[model samples]
Target: MTSHAQSQAIAPKGISRFIPILSIGVLFFIFGFITWLNGALIPFLQMVCELSEMQALFIAFCFYIAYVVMALPMAKILEKTGYQKGMSVGLGIIAIGCVLFVPAALTALFPVFLLAQFVVGSGLTILQTASNPFIVRLGNEESAAARIAFMGLLNKAAGVLAPIVFTTLVLSGLPEVNQELLNTLPEMERAALINDMSVSLIQPYVGMAVALGLLALVFMRLPLPVIEDNTVASVDTLSPASQNTQIWQYPHLVLGAISLFFYVGVEVIAGDTIGLYGSSIGVENATTLTSFTMVAMVLGYALGLLTIPRFVSQQAALLGSAVTGFIVTLGIVFADDSSLLISEILWGWTGIQQLPDTVTLIALLGFANAMVWPAIWPLALKDLGKYTAQGSALLIMGIAGGAILPVVYGGLSGLTGGQLAYMVMLPCYCFIGYYALWGCRKYTW
Candidate 1:
């Protein structure tokens, strides 16, 4: 084990350790609530802003690309601020971004909304960089994935609520917003309807801004235990032998980053695009479709909480996730889009809305994806010691896949339709399966 892991083994025991984990879980909840809002925002903005499918996905692009652009810089800031204060700073930044949405809504401008997304994403970059490593290093290395699974449970739970809450607040009373319907109306009436719907964003965002600002204050004063590793700040002080071991020398970490890129791509595609796909297939209240994906993920995380490090090792769980993801992606690609048979067998009696077969398959992808992040983080950061912070930043940068791949899906969906476009996920799962089986174990290139 690395020195950092050894130090963590002697970290605060009993209730003290639980406090930090609980605090970080709150941060993960914030991450999910803000990040997954893009799912509903995608179709909502597409209608409000008069965008094509590809343009609509730029909502995801501008949001996630900030991770790549700002991660290294955020790492630098964390080195100076330390993890606790940096989290407070991150929450403050997110609050600022949320406040920006007020102006974006008032003007009904897409550029302004894009700007708000970039700002919110930039803030999340800091929180993600700080909080992920914090959770991994807080306990025994063997159980780290389990800890992260618990956090994932919280995150995905928030994800389940975010879209439903968004649909309730912003879309509840609005008229249907497809272009065909708009084109059928008088021009003046269409503009007025779009303007009314756009402004519906104001109340919820203002509430988010206030709640986040208060959370920032609470986080700033929270009594969290501090870990004593040098992180990135003291890298220059290492002996020549330690300094000679460049981050590139760790093949597992590098490959893990690449694997994470594909993992996040498929995760975002499943979470965000499901709504748009449902809309195209004539599902009512398509914005709430993300809740179905989130529900699946929540179930997966609950399973992980029970089995990880006990009934199953993190590595085995990861392999299972990849295999399941591969099978589900195939179902998404080939399932008959008009069939409600899958939904009927699954939840038809619950009185919940039944999705078409293809859409149901896409939601199952969430179950396949839930374990990937939890499993990968501990495995990738294993034995990095003082390089852990840098490794975390690298993995965080891999989230760019969320920004890039969905746009690719959007463009491809335009050509081949939404169902077949899921073929893109096949190679992604293949790569993740490779990582789970072999790439994670190869420490040397």
Candidate 2:
């Protein structure tokens, strides 16, 4: 096949399509808000439920591992429902999960809350499967990373909002609460205070449920142009190499899936675990650090959108991001875990900034972490042809790493302490660096 045919295969039209693309971008924005909020929730749940580090991080395990259990099934479901209907259905499922949170909060039951997270993750699994590939297929294959970066702009923007909003609502006065906990308060009164705090959780989830429900209805009525995986081989024209019955035979896709596993793991470690790490180190504003991370990510995505293929190839961008991630991982681990105070940040725009040396290093990771997904999705999904969804399922399932790493970090932090636990992220980035430098191009057929 000529380059021209390949281009034709991927690009359905000469014009830049808007509605479907923007719609999917909005979905990804929701994804960022939901996924990254776990950072704040880690500490919040730990304090509220009076659980240990291991138990609190089970929030990540319950939430992200659902992607593994649901990804393949979502792929199959999308085949029947198609992307548009599948997304609407997925939104509905998320709304149901959001509603489940109300009762979980009412009972103050941790397991019930995990159930809600799993349900929400299941819905997100469907949305991710339907949307990532759909968005990638809409434009020029060479510029796919740039397009995804545009969505990342929206995504991290929401990520920036989620932590600030969630922590402000759910974790407000947490410092005072901790200080009060150190004093003698009546047990019954303390329990009453905790329950009142739990009520704060109810309103936010109610708002999410209503938003998701409305979005589902909007998608049902909206007419999106029909889309297909342009990157997939027709299977009809499958040569012996392409005709392999197993998706694993596509070495790039398999490695890509594995890469995503580590990518997500490290990304979560940087964003989610940092809050707890910050709190452990006595940063009063630790709950809001995820916003700083998200801001850094937005900067990275902005750079990616501006520079990719124009200033840097996607593979080169990945290589740089991985190297930066590895170095930041080292910095976070080896840095002095000391705390400092600042009266103003952003030229006195924000009132106070609590700078923990280790926390700052971890948050800097958002810059290193931003370009990985944009690069990974396009590289892994490259030329999967008819196996696109199958390959996508495996990659989505790799999100289970989010479940694995944070819990490991929690355990390691419990054992060796917070700063040392970040060493776990080092090898994760080394593998990512390896992929960007080698794996994506190693088995080109």
Candidate 3:
């Protein structure tokens, strides 16, 4: 072959390196789709199952707590099987979980649904354990932020679409349907109608199971490179020796972890509770407002895609986002109870208009949360060499903050009412702000 033709052949081979990373992005999309659907599910399940606020939030607890419970074991599993096999196994587990929804829906049993969600989350823990470190190891460490940012776009885009799709199917027109059924039906028929409504979830989960199965088959066929963890035991980033080694031992990683935890909590709150919050403040049709939250998240992902690396530093993006989060929290706190200011600022730019104040603020939180995960993961995993996988596992565990913080918000809403209950978000943003500033700086140890 001519030298130029040989170069062209090698170029495509080099481009193949990105295929694994791109596949990881697809996994991220699946994760986001499942995770963000909790926003719609919490309220829908609450009404169907007749749950209290605290009880409803158990949806989040069930889903996210799996990360904490399963991260280490998942890491070990990945170590034994390698990324490709581990990912296929994880997807299989998730498919099983999705299938579990059939029984859960048939019984209209809330705890059964929670159990299925936990199982799905356990599977996701394994997927994230493999995918995160895989992306970081794909290329230059310094450029990890940009790659993660690209993944973030895929992840959040799924997050944006999930609520809109699920709500439309399950919750959007339920009241009207219920009203029509009530007018024409006897008491026995009314009970059957309500039960049938809850059971509608079965078909959606069946579709999810089929999609997961196809993705698993495809992932099994893909060519994925394995990246070994190379950090020394004594020098491990998350080791006990490293624990007493001062917070500065890995300033960027620790701060990034903290930022990730708080960012997740805030994002969960925004997406999960906004619909309920809208009801509390007298928005007539609350579930419809959930779209504004997804739209806001989509806008943030769009901005990150355009602006990260080329237009701005990840650190700067994080800092600015933290400040905006703080401001939005304050707006939620002090804004007029009935004003559309929050919704206007969040969705008005897109020609979506007159959203409820609660939803608007929730959507705006999406912007503050946009760059956080992408920025923090790259910074945390930097220079970890061998411990990169374990560190990534720990970061995945930090997702439990989503489980915890929303329950706290729900409890606060129960005690103090929903509008004022947003006070909980203030402290989360405070921690994020701290991480963005002094927390993300270099370590000497």
Candidate 4:
């Protein structure tokens, strides 16, 4: 066993250990709320900013791209600030970013909003760099997946709340306002009306800014535990990529990065695009459909907490998630006609409501995704010991797939129709499943 693993295994047992985990859980909830807000923001920007399908996905791109840009810098920052101060700095930066929404909303500039997302994502990069590996260091290696699952539950519950809350505050009028926004009109008049229609944006983000600022202050004052290790920090022009020439030396780490990259892509697609997908399919209250996905994810996280390391192994959990993801994506492809017979039978008998085929399958992707993140992190960082922080940085950088792949989906949807564009998720899940079965092990590359 690695020294890090052994230390945690024989680590002192007390309420103090749980305190740091609980504190990190709070940070996780904060970022999850922030991250999933992109789901609400994407379509909101479409109408508010008068963006094309591809342009709006820049909302996601900017947010996730910060992880790639800032991961290594954040790692070096953590080396200086330590865990508690690093988290405080992250929260503070996010608060500043949230405050930027005031000017963005006031001017109604899409680029400024994108900038805000970028800044907030940068903050989250630092928080994640510190917290993820720290969570592993907190307890026994075997139970790491369970700890992450518990954190996932907190994370996803905020996800469920975010779209609902954002929709309530920002998008009040259901479809009528959307129809007005989409309808033909004089360009000057349409811009004025859109500006008026989206006047609620400032207040919500101001509230978020204030909340985040207070949390940052609270984190600074809290007595969090310390872990010891030293790294050479290069704030010079030297890039982390160039400095770590030997990063690719770890085959499992590289493969894990690939698996996480594709995993994040589909997870974002399922969470962020579902509302838009529902809208295209003519579902009433399309934005509300996002809650269905989040609810499914919450259930998956809770199940993982109960069963992992006891009823099911971490690798087994990952395999189950990936297989389920593949089945659901296939179900989405054949959703309409395939469900017709079952719909008819169910309606003919008890008269219960039938789900829209696409949204139903999209929602199920949430359950498939929930376990993937919790399982992948532990497996990827399993035995890295001193390299654990850098490994975490690599995996976090892979999260940029969330940015790149969804924009591809959005642009493709515009060309080929939204329903057909969902084919992208299949290959993503296939990679995750491959990792689950084989690629997670050492020398499997």
Q: Model 3 has how many clashing residue pairs?
A: 3
Between candidates 2 and 4, the one scoring higher on TM-score is: 2
TM-scores, one per candidate:
0.95, 0.92, 0.87, 0.89
- For candidate 4, the 10 contiguous residues with the lowest summed lDDT are 233-242
Rank the models by lDDT, top first.
1, 2, 4, 3
- Local distance difference test, each candidate: 0.88, 0.82, 0.75, 0.80
Residue-level lDDT of model 1, residues 90-146, one tens digit each, is: 998999999999999999999999999999999999999999988887877788889
- Candidate 1: worst 10 consecutive residues by lDDT? 232-241
Model 2 weakest 10-residue run by lDDT: 339-348
Off by over 4 Å in 1: 1-10, 13-15, 176-180, 231-244
Tens digit per residue, CA lDDT, model 4, 295-351 = 789999999999999999999999999889988898887788235354344343666
Q: How much is 281 displaced in model 2, in angstroms?
A: 1.4
Model 1: residue 255 alpha-carbon error in angstroms:
0.9
Candidate 3 local distance difference test against the native: 0.75
Query: How far off is residue 218 in model 2, in Å?
Result: 0.8
lDDT of 3 by residue, 285-399 (tens): 4554555666666677678768777788777777887888888888877767667775566456877557666557766787777777777887776555456667788888888
| Candidate 3 Cα deviation (angstroms), residue 314 | 2.0
- Model 4, which residues run further than 4 Å from truth? 1-15, 172-176, 179-189, 229-245, 337-354, 443-445
Of 2 and 3, the candidate ahead on TM-score is 2
The clash numbers for all candidates, in the given order, read: 0, 2, 3, 0
Scored by lDDT, the top model is 1
